[model samples]
Target: DVKVTQSSRYLVKRTGEKVFLECVQDMDHENMFWYRQDPGLGLRLIYFSYDVKMKEKGDIPEGYSVSREKKERFSLILESASTNQTSMYLCASSLYSGRRYEQYFGPGTRLTVT
Candidate 1:
């Protein structure tokens, strides 16, 4: 089964504190992604990595970054957690077979910046 695991289910961070959220996929998918899900706004991509040690910025990469050091693991880093950054962060992964692959999502990490 394709499974994705997020590091935290919930987080309370102060404004300006660096935050890190980790994710891992057991299925050897080549594309891993970080996204923030908000009400009425839908899912917005934060970053993605296509391969180990390679990364790319996504739609909302501004205060956020990502790392993919190994095939099964991906990490999202928030330079400084802000009140506006508080939201549900989801991690997803998809295969690179050129076929239409649906992303498998994690349980999500709800962050509250105070």
Candidate 2:
């Protein structure tokens, strides 16, 4: 029973406008992650994808952009919305299964830019 689905929990954009955050994982995980959390510059991993079209770019990833065609779905893009790119946006799902892999979280999407 591993589920991570987040289309939006809360989002308010104004500056520049162009924001889309969506994530869904029904356990068929291969590895998918997109994170952003401020407060001390804590968890900051912008994009990740293990299969389905393939993608990898973590550690901020600038303005942010990501999309996984299938494999449960994962999309996060905010090309213009500024205000230092308001924080708290996280979506993760993992099943690497090599040594250490335990990530399942998607109850976040706070974004507020004005």
Per-model TM-score versus the true fold: 0.96, 0.32
Question: In terms of TM-score, how similar is model 2 to the real structure?
Answer: 0.32
Question: What would the per-residue lDDT of candidate 2 be over residues 1-114, giving only the tens digit for each residue?
Answer: 798989989999999988999999998999999999999778989889988879999977988788888999999998889999988899999988776488999999999999
**Candidate 1 lDDT by residue in tens digits, 11-103:** 999999999999999999999999999999999999999899999899989999888889999999999888999999999999988794899
- Pairs clashing within candidate 2: none
Tell me the lDDT of model 1 at 112: 97
* Candidate 1 off by > 4 Å: 98-100
Determine which window of 10 residues in candidate 1 has minimal summed lDDT. Answer: 96-105
Number of the top lDDT candidate: 1
Candidate number achieving the greatest TM-score relative to the actual structure: 1
Candidate 2 accuracy as lDDT: 0.90
lDDT over C-alpha atoms for residue 39 of model 1: 99
